[model samples]
Target: MTAMMDREAFEAALRQIGAERYHHLHPFQQMLQNGQLSREQVQAWALNRYYYQSQIPVKDSHILARLQTTELRREWRQRIIDHDGQEASEGQPAQRGGIEKWIALTDGVGLDRAYVESGAGILPGTRFAVDAYVHFVQEKTLLEAIASSLTELFSPNVIGTRVRGMLEHYDFISRETLAYFDKRPVQAKRDSDFALEYCLENARRPEEQEAVLNALRFKCHVLWAQLDALCFAYVAPGLTPADAWQPGTAEKENPRS
Candidate 1:
Protein backbone atom coordinates (compact mmCIF):
# COMPACT_ATOMS: atom_id res chain seq x y z
CA MET A 1 0.00 0.00 0.00
CA THR A 2 1.09 3.55 -0.57
CA ALA A 3 2.22 5.53 2.45
CA MET A 4 0.23 8.48 3.67
CA MET A 5 1.58 11.81 2.56
CA ASP A 6 2.32 14.64 4.94
CA ARG A 7 -0.23 17.46 5.06
CA GLU A 8 1.98 19.72 2.94
CA ALA A 9 2.46 17.04 0.31
CA PHE A 10 -1.21 16.14 0.25
CA GLU A 11 -2.18 19.77 -0.26
CA ALA A 12 0.35 20.01 -3.07
CA ALA A 13 -1.10 16.94 -4.73
CA LEU A 14 -4.58 18.46 -4.59
CA ARG A 15 -3.41 21.71 -6.14
CA GLN A 16 -1.61 19.70 -8.81
CA ILE A 17 -4.94 18.22 -9.91
CA GLY A 18 -6.31 21.68 -10.63
CA ALA A 19 -3.13 22.69 -12.49
CA GLU A 20 -3.41 19.67 -14.74
CA ARG A 21 -7.16 19.34 -15.25
CA TYR A 22 -9.01 22.62 -14.57
CA HIS A 23 -11.26 23.91 -17.34
CA HIS A 24 -9.25 27.11 -17.59
CA LEU A 25 -7.04 25.13 -19.97
CA HIS A 26 -9.96 24.00 -22.13
CA PRO A 27 -10.06 25.31 -25.70
CA PHE A 28 -13.50 26.77 -25.19
CA GLN A 29 -12.32 28.71 -22.15
CA GLN A 30 -9.22 29.88 -24.00
CA MET A 31 -11.33 31.19 -26.85
CA LEU A 32 -13.63 32.88 -24.37
CA GLN A 33 -10.76 34.62 -22.58
CA ASN A 34 -9.16 35.67 -25.90
CA GLY A 35 -12.31 37.18 -27.44
CA GLN A 36 -12.58 34.62 -30.21
CA LEU A 37 -16.22 33.56 -29.87
CA SER A 38 -19.14 35.43 -31.45
CA ARG A 39 -22.03 37.15 -29.68
CA GLU A 40 -24.40 34.26 -30.14
CA GLN A 41 -21.79 31.93 -28.75
CA VAL A 42 -21.37 34.15 -25.72
CA GLN A 43 -25.10 34.26 -25.16
CA ALA A 44 -25.26 30.51 -25.38
CA TRP A 45 -22.56 30.28 -22.76
CA ALA A 46 -24.37 32.61 -20.35
CA LEU A 47 -27.68 30.87 -20.74
CA ASN A 48 -26.29 27.40 -20.24
CA ARG A 49 -24.02 28.38 -17.38
CA TYR A 50 -26.99 29.70 -15.42
CA TYR A 51 -28.02 26.12 -14.79
CA TYR A 52 -24.73 25.41 -13.13
CA GLN A 53 -24.90 28.62 -11.14
CA SER A 54 -28.34 27.88 -9.83
CA GLN A 55 -27.30 24.48 -8.56
CA ILE A 56 -24.31 25.55 -6.47
CA PRO A 57 -26.37 26.26 -3.38
CA VAL A 58 -28.14 22.98 -3.79
CA LYS A 59 -24.82 21.18 -3.76
CA ASP A 60 -23.68 23.09 -0.71
CA SER A 61 -26.91 22.36 1.12
CA HIS A 62 -26.20 18.67 0.79
CA ILE A 63 -22.76 19.17 2.27
CA LEU A 64 -24.10 21.33 5.08
CA ALA A 65 -26.56 18.66 6.14
CA ARG A 66 -23.90 15.98 6.47
CA LEU A 67 -21.60 18.08 8.62
CA GLN A 68 -21.70 16.86 12.24
CA THR A 69 -20.48 19.95 14.03
CA THR A 70 -22.16 23.32 14.37
CA GLU A 71 -18.86 24.95 13.60
CA LEU A 72 -18.59 23.15 10.29
CA ARG A 73 -22.21 23.72 9.42
CA ARG A 74 -21.92 27.39 10.27
CA GLU A 75 -18.99 27.74 7.89
CA TRP A 76 -20.69 25.74 5.17
CA ARG A 77 -23.93 27.69 5.53
CA GLN A 78 -22.26 30.81 4.18
CA ARG A 79 -21.84 29.15 0.80
CA ILE A 80 -25.58 28.70 0.38
CA ILE A 81 -26.23 32.26 1.55
CA ASP A 82 -23.64 33.60 -0.88
CA HIS A 83 -25.48 32.02 -3.75
CA ASP A 84 -29.09 32.37 -2.55
CA GLY A 85 -28.94 35.92 -1.18
CA GLN A 86 -30.89 37.35 1.76
CA GLU A 87 -34.41 38.72 1.86
CA ALA A 88 -35.24 42.29 2.78
CA SER A 89 -35.65 42.97 6.49
CA GLU A 90 -37.53 45.64 8.40
CA GLY A 91 -34.84 48.22 7.84
CA GLN A 92 -32.31 46.78 5.43
CA PRO A 93 -32.27 46.31 1.67
CA ALA A 94 -32.06 42.83 0.24
CA GLN A 95 -28.61 41.58 -0.54
CA ARG A 96 -28.30 40.22 -4.05
CA GLY A 97 -27.06 36.66 -4.20
CA GLY A 98 -24.82 34.96 -6.73
CA ILE A 99 -27.76 33.35 -8.50
CA GLU A 100 -29.48 36.69 -8.96
CA LYS A 101 -26.24 38.22 -10.15
CA TRP A 102 -25.89 35.39 -12.63
CA ILE A 103 -29.41 36.07 -13.86
CA ALA A 104 -28.44 39.66 -14.38
CA LEU A 105 -25.51 38.40 -16.41
CA THR A 106 -27.80 36.33 -18.57
CA ASP A 107 -30.01 39.37 -18.95
CA GLY A 108 -27.00 41.41 -19.98
CA VAL A 109 -26.25 38.86 -22.65
CA GLY A 110 -29.83 39.12 -24.04
CA LEU A 111 -31.31 35.92 -22.72
CA ASP A 112 -34.81 36.11 -21.24
CA ARG A 113 -34.38 35.32 -17.51
CA ALA A 114 -37.43 33.12 -17.43
CA TYR A 115 -36.24 31.05 -20.33
CA VAL A 116 -32.81 30.66 -18.82
CA GLU A 117 -34.23 29.61 -15.46
CA SER A 118 -36.54 27.11 -17.05
CA GLY A 119 -33.60 24.90 -17.95
CA ALA A 120 -35.65 23.88 -20.94
CA GLY A 121 -32.94 24.41 -23.53
CA ILE A 122 -29.66 23.44 -21.89
CA LEU A 123 -27.60 20.65 -23.47
CA PRO A 124 -28.03 17.11 -22.20
CA GLY A 125 -24.30 17.04 -21.55
CA THR A 126 -24.55 20.09 -19.30
CA ARG A 127 -27.49 18.73 -17.35
CA PHE A 128 -25.82 15.40 -16.84
CA ALA A 129 -22.52 16.89 -15.75
CA VAL A 130 -24.07 19.31 -13.24
CA ASP A 131 -26.48 16.74 -11.86
CA ALA A 132 -23.56 14.42 -11.35
CA TYR A 133 -21.85 17.07 -9.22
CA VAL A 134 -24.90 17.54 -7.04
CA HIS A 135 -25.28 13.79 -6.58
CA PHE A 136 -21.59 13.43 -5.79
CA VAL A 137 -21.76 15.67 -2.76
CA GLN A 138 -24.92 13.97 -1.59
CA GLU A 139 -23.54 10.45 -1.78
CA LYS A 140 -19.84 10.77 -1.09
CA THR A 141 -18.14 10.84 2.31
CA LEU A 142 -17.99 14.31 3.88
CA LEU A 143 -14.22 14.54 3.44
CA GLU A 144 -14.44 13.63 -0.23
CA ALA A 145 -17.26 16.12 -0.70
CA ILE A 146 -15.27 18.93 0.87
CA ALA A 147 -12.19 17.90 -1.13
CA SER A 148 -14.18 18.23 -4.34
CA SER A 149 -14.68 21.88 -3.57
CA LEU A 150 -10.92 22.35 -3.75
CA THR A 151 -11.52 23.39 -7.37
CA GLU A 152 -12.22 26.82 -5.96
CA LEU A 153 -8.50 27.11 -5.15
CA PHE A 154 -7.93 27.60 -8.88
CA SER A 155 -10.95 29.77 -9.77
CA PRO A 156 -9.81 33.26 -8.77
CA ASN A 157 -7.14 33.31 -11.47
CA VAL A 158 -9.47 32.06 -14.17
CA ILE A 159 -12.16 34.53 -13.10
CA GLY A 160 -9.65 37.36 -13.40
CA THR A 161 -8.64 36.32 -16.91
CA ARG A 162 -12.22 35.82 -18.06
CA VAL A 163 -13.43 39.14 -16.65
CA ARG A 164 -10.62 41.02 -18.35
CA GLY A 165 -10.94 39.23 -21.68
CA MET A 166 -14.69 39.60 -21.94
CA LEU A 167 -14.60 43.32 -21.18
CA GLU A 168 -11.86 43.90 -23.75
CA HIS A 169 -13.17 41.71 -26.54
CA TYR A 170 -16.93 41.61 -26.30
CA ASP A 171 -18.88 44.81 -26.82
CA PHE A 172 -21.90 43.09 -25.32
CA ILE A 173 -20.11 42.22 -22.09
CA SER A 174 -20.00 44.79 -19.31
CA ARG A 175 -18.30 44.73 -15.93
CA GLU A 176 -21.73 45.31 -14.45
CA THR A 177 -23.11 42.33 -16.29
CA LEU A 178 -20.24 40.16 -15.13
CA ALA A 179 -20.62 41.19 -11.50
CA TYR A 180 -21.12 37.59 -10.50
CA PHE A 181 -17.41 37.03 -11.05
CA ASP A 182 -16.20 40.15 -9.31
CA LYS A 183 -17.04 38.86 -5.82
CA ARG A 184 -16.21 35.24 -6.55
CA PRO A 185 -12.45 35.41 -6.16
CA VAL A 186 -12.65 36.55 -2.57
CA GLN A 187 -15.42 34.13 -1.71
CA ALA A 188 -13.67 31.29 -3.45
CA LYS A 189 -10.52 31.98 -1.52
CA ARG A 190 -12.26 31.98 1.86
CA ASP A 191 -14.27 28.86 1.09
CA SER A 192 -11.37 26.98 -0.40
CA ASP A 193 -9.11 27.80 2.53
CA PHE A 194 -11.57 26.27 4.94
CA ALA A 195 -12.24 23.26 2.73
CA LEU A 196 -8.54 22.60 2.16
CA GLU A 197 -7.88 22.70 5.90
CA TYR A 198 -10.75 20.32 6.49
CA CYS A 199 -9.53 17.91 3.85
CA LEU A 200 -5.93 17.92 5.05
CA GLU A 201 -6.87 17.25 8.66
CA ASN A 202 -9.50 14.62 7.91
CA ALA A 203 -7.66 12.58 5.32
CA ARG A 204 -5.32 10.92 7.85
CA ARG A 205 -4.82 7.51 6.23
CA PRO A 206 -3.17 6.71 2.88
CA GLU A 207 -6.42 5.45 1.38
CA GLU A 208 -8.31 8.46 2.71
CA GLN A 209 -5.70 10.81 1.29
CA GLU A 210 -5.96 9.09 -2.04
CA ALA A 211 -9.72 9.45 -1.91
CA VAL A 212 -9.33 13.16 -1.31
CA LEU A 213 -7.02 13.49 -4.30
CA ASN A 214 -9.37 11.55 -6.52
CA ALA A 215 -12.28 13.71 -5.38
CA LEU A 216 -10.46 16.82 -6.51
CA ARG A 217 -9.70 15.17 -9.84
CA PHE A 218 -13.35 14.25 -10.23
CA LYS A 219 -14.33 17.88 -9.70
CA CYS A 220 -11.91 19.03 -12.35
CA HIS A 221 -13.51 16.60 -14.76
CA VAL A 222 -16.94 17.92 -13.84
CA LEU A 223 -15.90 21.44 -14.76
CA TRP A 224 -14.01 20.29 -17.84
CA ALA A 225 -16.95 18.22 -19.02
CA GLN A 226 -19.24 21.28 -18.93
CA LEU A 227 -16.85 23.19 -21.19
CA ASP A 228 -16.50 20.18 -23.47
CA ALA A 229 -20.23 20.17 -23.98
CA LEU A 230 -20.18 23.89 -24.72
CA CYS A 231 -17.35 23.56 -27.25
CA PHE A 232 -18.88 20.60 -29.04
CA ALA A 233 -22.35 22.06 -29.22
CA TYR A 234 -21.49 25.69 -29.94
CA VAL A 235 -17.97 26.00 -31.38
CA ALA A 236 -17.29 23.06 -33.67
CA PRO A 237 -19.57 21.36 -36.13
CA GLY A 238 -22.30 23.19 -34.23
CA LEU A 239 -24.65 20.27 -34.16
CA THR A 240 -26.72 21.67 -31.33
CA PRO A 241 -28.99 19.11 -29.79
CA ALA A 242 -32.52 19.24 -31.15
CA ASP A 243 -33.88 20.17 -27.75
CA ALA A 244 -30.98 22.35 -26.67
CA TRP A 245 -31.11 26.13 -26.92
CA GLN A 246 -30.38 27.61 -30.33
CA PRO A 247 -28.46 30.87 -30.71
CA GLY A 248 -31.21 33.23 -31.77
CA THR A 249 -34.15 31.43 -30.30
CA ALA A 250 -35.68 32.81 -27.09
CA GLU A 251 -33.35 35.81 -26.99
CA LYS A 252 -34.21 39.29 -25.75
CA GLU A 253 -32.94 42.55 -27.28
CA ASN A 254 -29.26 42.82 -26.34
CA PRO A 255 -29.17 46.21 -24.62
CA ARG A 256 -25.43 45.91 -24.03
CA SER A 257 -24.85 45.75 -27.76
Candidate 2:
Protein backbone atom coordinates (compact mmCIF):
# COMPACT_ATOMS: atom_id res chain seq x y z
CA MET A 1 0.00 0.00 0.00
CA THR A 2 1.21 3.50 -0.73
CA ALA A 3 2.08 5.48 2.35
CA MET A 4 -0.33 8.31 2.93
CA MET A 5 1.18 11.67 2.37
CA ASP A 6 0.41 14.34 4.98
CA ARG A 7 -2.63 16.50 4.31
CA GLU A 8 -0.64 19.48 3.11
CA ALA A 9 1.52 17.20 0.94
CA PHE A 10 -1.57 15.55 -0.50
CA GLU A 11 -3.17 18.87 -1.34
CA ALA A 12 0.01 20.15 -2.91
CA ALA A 13 0.32 16.96 -4.95
CA LEU A 14 -3.21 17.35 -6.29
CA ARG A 15 -2.49 20.94 -7.25
CA GLN A 16 0.56 19.64 -9.10
CA ILE A 17 -1.64 17.41 -11.21
CA GLY A 18 -3.61 20.44 -12.33
CA ALA A 19 -0.43 22.37 -12.96
CA GLU A 20 0.92 19.63 -15.20
CA ARG A 21 -2.04 17.94 -16.93
CA TYR A 22 -4.92 20.42 -17.06
CA HIS A 23 -6.34 21.32 -20.48
CA HIS A 24 -5.13 24.87 -20.10
CA LEU A 25 -1.78 23.49 -21.21
CA HIS A 26 -3.12 22.06 -24.44
CA PRO A 27 -2.05 23.55 -27.78
CA PHE A 28 -5.67 24.12 -28.70
CA GLN A 29 -6.04 26.34 -25.63
CA GLN A 30 -2.83 28.22 -26.45
CA MET A 31 -4.14 29.00 -29.93
CA LEU A 32 -7.44 30.03 -28.42
CA GLN A 33 -5.96 32.47 -25.91
CA ASN A 34 -3.28 33.70 -28.33
CA GLY A 35 -5.90 34.91 -30.83
CA GLN A 36 -4.62 32.64 -33.58
CA LEU A 37 -7.74 30.68 -34.52
CA SER A 38 -10.04 31.84 -37.30
CA ARG A 39 -13.62 32.90 -36.71
CA GLU A 40 -14.81 29.48 -37.81
CA GLN A 41 -12.41 27.77 -35.46
CA VAL A 42 -13.61 30.00 -32.63
CA GLN A 43 -17.15 29.15 -33.61
CA ALA A 44 -16.33 25.47 -33.38
CA TRP A 45 -14.87 25.96 -29.90
CA ALA A 46 -17.88 27.86 -28.51
CA LEU A 47 -20.36 25.44 -30.05
CA ASN A 48 -18.59 22.39 -28.73
CA ARG A 49 -17.89 23.84 -25.30
CA TYR A 50 -21.60 24.46 -24.78
CA TYR A 51 -22.17 20.72 -24.66
CA TYR A 52 -19.85 20.48 -21.68
CA GLN A 53 -21.40 23.45 -19.86
CA SER A 54 -24.93 22.14 -20.31
CA GLN A 55 -24.08 18.77 -18.74
CA ILE A 56 -22.67 20.28 -15.55
CA PRO A 57 -25.96 20.31 -13.69
CA VAL A 58 -26.79 16.80 -14.79
CA LYS A 59 -23.54 15.56 -13.31
CA ASP A 60 -24.00 17.62 -10.16
CA SER A 61 -27.54 16.35 -9.75
CA HIS A 62 -26.31 12.79 -9.86
CA ILE A 63 -23.86 13.53 -7.09
CA LEU A 64 -26.40 15.51 -5.15
CA ALA A 65 -28.83 12.60 -5.03
CA ARG A 66 -26.23 10.37 -3.45
CA LEU A 67 -25.17 12.75 -0.68
CA GLN A 68 -26.37 11.57 2.76
CA THR A 69 -26.40 14.79 4.75
CA THR A 70 -28.83 17.68 4.49
CA GLU A 71 -26.04 20.21 4.75
CA LEU A 72 -24.14 18.51 1.97
CA ARG A 73 -27.16 18.48 -0.31
CA ARG A 74 -27.77 22.12 0.49
CA GLU A 75 -24.28 22.93 -0.63
CA TRP A 76 -24.53 20.69 -3.70
CA ARG A 77 -27.91 21.90 -4.87
CA GLN A 78 -26.61 25.43 -5.39
CA ARG A 79 -24.42 24.09 -8.18
CA ILE A 80 -27.48 22.84 -10.03
CA ILE A 81 -29.22 26.16 -9.48
CA ASP A 82 -26.19 28.05 -10.70
CA HIS A 83 -26.46 26.35 -14.06
CA ASP A 84 -30.20 25.60 -14.28
CA GLY A 85 -31.47 28.75 -12.54
CA GLN A 86 -34.35 29.08 -10.10
CA GLU A 87 -37.94 28.10 -10.78
CA ALA A 88 -39.74 31.04 -12.36
CA SER A 89 -43.34 32.11 -11.97
CA GLU A 90 -45.64 32.63 -14.90
CA GLY A 91 -45.34 36.09 -16.50
CA GLN A 92 -42.16 36.77 -14.54
CA PRO A 93 -38.77 37.08 -16.17
CA ALA A 94 -36.49 34.07 -15.81
CA GLN A 95 -33.41 34.24 -13.63
CA ARG A 96 -30.39 34.08 -15.89
CA GLY A 97 -28.45 30.83 -15.62
CA GLY A 98 -25.20 29.52 -16.95
CA ILE A 99 -26.91 27.55 -19.70
CA GLU A 100 -28.67 30.65 -20.97
CA LYS A 101 -25.43 32.58 -20.80
CA TRP A 102 -23.76 29.87 -22.85
CA ILE A 103 -26.52 30.18 -25.44
CA ALA A 104 -25.80 33.87 -25.64
CA LEU A 105 -22.19 33.05 -26.35
CA THR A 106 -23.12 30.69 -29.16
CA ASP A 107 -25.49 33.27 -30.60
CA GLY A 108 -22.83 35.94 -30.40
CA VAL A 109 -20.61 33.62 -32.42
CA GLY A 110 -23.38 33.40 -35.09
CA LEU A 111 -24.54 29.87 -34.24
CA ASP A 112 -28.27 29.17 -34.48
CA ARG A 113 -29.83 28.75 -31.05
CA ALA A 114 -31.81 25.75 -32.29
CA TYR A 115 -28.69 24.07 -33.66
CA VAL A 116 -26.75 24.65 -30.47
CA GLU A 117 -29.64 23.55 -28.26
CA SER A 118 -30.36 20.45 -30.31
CA GLY A 119 -26.67 19.61 -30.05
CA ALA A 120 -26.84 17.67 -33.29
CA GLY A 121 -24.02 19.80 -34.67
CA ILE A 122 -21.40 19.25 -31.97
CA LEU A 123 -18.35 16.98 -32.35
CA PRO A 124 -18.59 13.28 -31.44
CA GLY A 125 -15.76 13.82 -28.99
CA THR A 126 -17.79 16.46 -27.20
CA ARG A 127 -20.75 14.17 -26.56
CA PHE A 128 -18.58 11.30 -25.43
CA ALA A 129 -16.56 13.40 -23.05
CA VAL A 130 -19.52 15.14 -21.48
CA ASP A 131 -21.54 11.95 -21.16
CA ALA A 132 -18.65 10.16 -19.53
CA TYR A 133 -18.47 12.82 -16.81
CA VAL A 134 -22.15 12.39 -15.98
CA HIS A 135 -21.73 8.64 -15.80
CA PHE A 136 -18.67 8.82 -13.58
CA VAL A 137 -20.52 10.81 -10.96
CA GLN A 138 -23.46 8.41 -11.02
CA GLU A 139 -21.32 5.28 -10.80
CA LYS A 140 -18.39 6.23 -8.58
CA THR A 141 -18.16 6.14 -4.79
CA LEU A 142 -19.34 9.31 -3.11
CA LEU A 143 -15.87 10.39 -2.12
CA GLU A 144 -14.51 9.86 -5.61
CA ALA A 145 -17.42 11.67 -7.17
CA ILE A 146 -16.73 14.73 -5.04
CA ALA A 147 -13.03 14.54 -5.75
CA SER A 148 -13.64 14.79 -9.48
CA SER A 149 -14.96 18.29 -8.97
CA LEU A 150 -11.54 19.36 -7.77
CA THR A 151 -11.01 20.53 -11.34
CA GLU A 152 -12.73 23.66 -10.13
CA LEU A 153 -9.53 24.43 -8.23
CA PHE A 154 -7.75 25.27 -11.46
CA SER A 155 -10.68 26.80 -13.33
CA PRO A 156 -10.48 30.38 -12.11
CA ASN A 157 -7.09 30.83 -13.67
CA VAL A 158 -8.25 29.33 -16.93
CA ILE A 159 -11.45 31.36 -16.92
CA GLY A 160 -9.52 34.56 -16.25
CA THR A 161 -7.19 33.84 -19.15
CA ARG A 162 -10.01 32.86 -21.53
CA VAL A 163 -12.19 35.89 -20.75
CA ARG A 164 -9.29 38.29 -21.19
CA GLY A 165 -7.98 36.67 -24.35
CA MET A 166 -11.32 36.38 -26.10
CA LEU A 167 -12.32 39.94 -25.29
CA GLU A 168 -9.04 41.31 -26.55
CA HIS A 169 -8.96 39.31 -29.76
CA TYR A 170 -12.39 38.22 -31.01
CA ASP A 171 -14.63 41.01 -32.20
CA PHE A 172 -17.66 38.81 -31.72
CA ILE A 173 -16.69 37.90 -28.14
CA SER A 174 -17.48 40.53 -25.54
CA ARG A 175 -17.99 40.99 -21.81
CA GLU A 176 -21.69 40.51 -22.49
CA THR A 177 -21.25 37.35 -24.53
CA LEU A 178 -18.85 35.90 -21.98
CA ALA A 179 -21.00 36.81 -18.99
CA TYR A 180 -21.27 33.11 -18.15
CA PHE A 181 -17.69 33.21 -16.87
CA ASP A 182 -17.88 36.37 -14.82
CA LYS A 183 -19.32 34.70 -11.73
CA ARG A 184 -17.63 31.33 -12.09
CA PRO A 185 -14.37 32.19 -10.41
CA VAL A 186 -16.08 32.85 -7.11
CA GLN A 187 -18.34 29.81 -7.51
CA ALA A 188 -15.42 27.59 -8.41
CA LYS A 189 -13.35 28.68 -5.44
CA ARG A 190 -16.16 27.94 -3.04
CA ASP A 191 -16.88 24.58 -4.65
CA SER A 192 -13.27 23.43 -4.82
CA ASP A 193 -12.56 24.44 -1.24
CA PHE A 194 -15.47 22.33 -0.09
CA ALA A 195 -14.56 19.38 -2.31
CA LEU A 196 -10.91 19.39 -1.30
CA GLU A 197 -11.82 19.51 2.37
CA TYR A 198 -14.28 16.67 1.85
CA CYS A 199 -11.64 14.49 0.27
CA LEU A 200 -9.03 15.23 2.88
CA GLU A 201 -11.44 14.48 5.70
CA ASN A 202 -13.10 11.38 4.28
CA ALA A 203 -10.23 9.62 2.59
CA ARG A 204 -8.65 8.00 5.60
CA ARG A 205 -7.10 4.97 3.96
CA PRO A 206 -4.20 5.30 1.57
CA GLU A 207 -6.07 3.58 -1.25
CA GLU A 208 -9.02 5.90 -0.83
CA GLN A 209 -6.66 8.82 -0.95
CA GLU A 210 -5.27 7.44 -4.18
CA ALA A 211 -8.79 7.16 -5.54
CA VAL A 212 -9.34 10.83 -4.82
CA LEU A 213 -6.20 11.75 -6.70
CA ASN A 214 -7.06 9.46 -9.60
CA ALA A 215 -10.54 10.95 -9.80
CA LEU A 216 -9.12 14.41 -10.32
CA ARG A 217 -6.70 13.00 -12.88
CA PHE A 218 -9.55 11.37 -14.77
CA LYS A 219 -11.39 14.69 -14.89
CA CYS A 220 -8.34 16.34 -16.33
CA HIS A 221 -8.35 13.67 -19.04
CA VAL A 222 -12.00 14.37 -19.79
CA LEU A 223 -11.25 18.06 -20.30
CA TRP A 224 -8.02 17.49 -22.20
CA ALA A 225 -9.59 14.90 -24.51
CA GLN A 226 -12.31 17.34 -25.57
CA LEU A 227 -9.66 19.84 -26.59
CA ASP A 228 -7.64 17.14 -28.36
CA ALA A 229 -10.60 16.33 -30.56
CA LEU A 230 -11.19 19.98 -31.30
CA CYS A 231 -7.55 20.55 -32.23
CA PHE A 232 -7.40 17.47 -34.44
CA ALA A 233 -10.62 18.05 -36.32
CA TYR A 234 -10.92 21.81 -36.39
CA VAL A 235 -7.46 23.29 -36.15
CA ALA A 236 -4.77 21.18 -37.79
CA PRO A 237 -6.07 18.56 -40.21
CA GLY A 238 -9.18 20.71 -40.58
CA LEU A 239 -11.45 17.70 -40.96
CA THR A 240 -14.63 17.91 -38.96
CA PRO A 241 -16.04 14.51 -38.17
CA ALA A 242 -19.08 13.21 -40.03
CA ASP A 243 -22.47 14.61 -38.93
CA ALA A 244 -20.77 17.28 -36.83
CA TRP A 245 -21.64 20.97 -37.16
CA GLN A 246 -20.55 22.68 -40.34
CA PRO A 247 -20.14 26.42 -40.46
CA GLY A 248 -23.21 28.36 -41.72
CA THR A 249 -25.64 25.55 -40.85
CA ALA A 250 -27.41 27.64 -38.21
CA GLU A 251 -31.20 27.83 -38.44
CA LYS A 252 -30.86 31.57 -38.53
CA GLU A 253 -28.63 32.95 -41.21
CA ASN A 254 -25.13 33.82 -39.98
CA PRO A 255 -24.49 37.51 -40.60
CA ARG A 256 -20.71 37.32 -40.21
CA SER A 257 -18.24 37.07 -43.10
In order, what is each prediction's RMSD in angstroms? Answer: 1.3, 2.1
Cα-based lDDT at residue 213, candidate 2: 94
For residues 48-144, could you state the per-residue lDDT of candidate 1 as single tens digits? 8899999999999999999999999999999999999999999999989999999999999888877999999999989999999999999889999
User: Quick one: best lDDT, which candidate?
Assistant: 1
In order of listing, the candidates' clash counts read 0, 0
Candidate with best TM-score: 1
| Residue-level lDDT tens digits of model 2 in 26-123 | 99998998899888888889899999999999999999999989999999999998998766789876778899999988888888888889888889
Model 1 residue 101 CA deviation (Å) reads 0.4
What clash pairs does model 1 have?
A: none
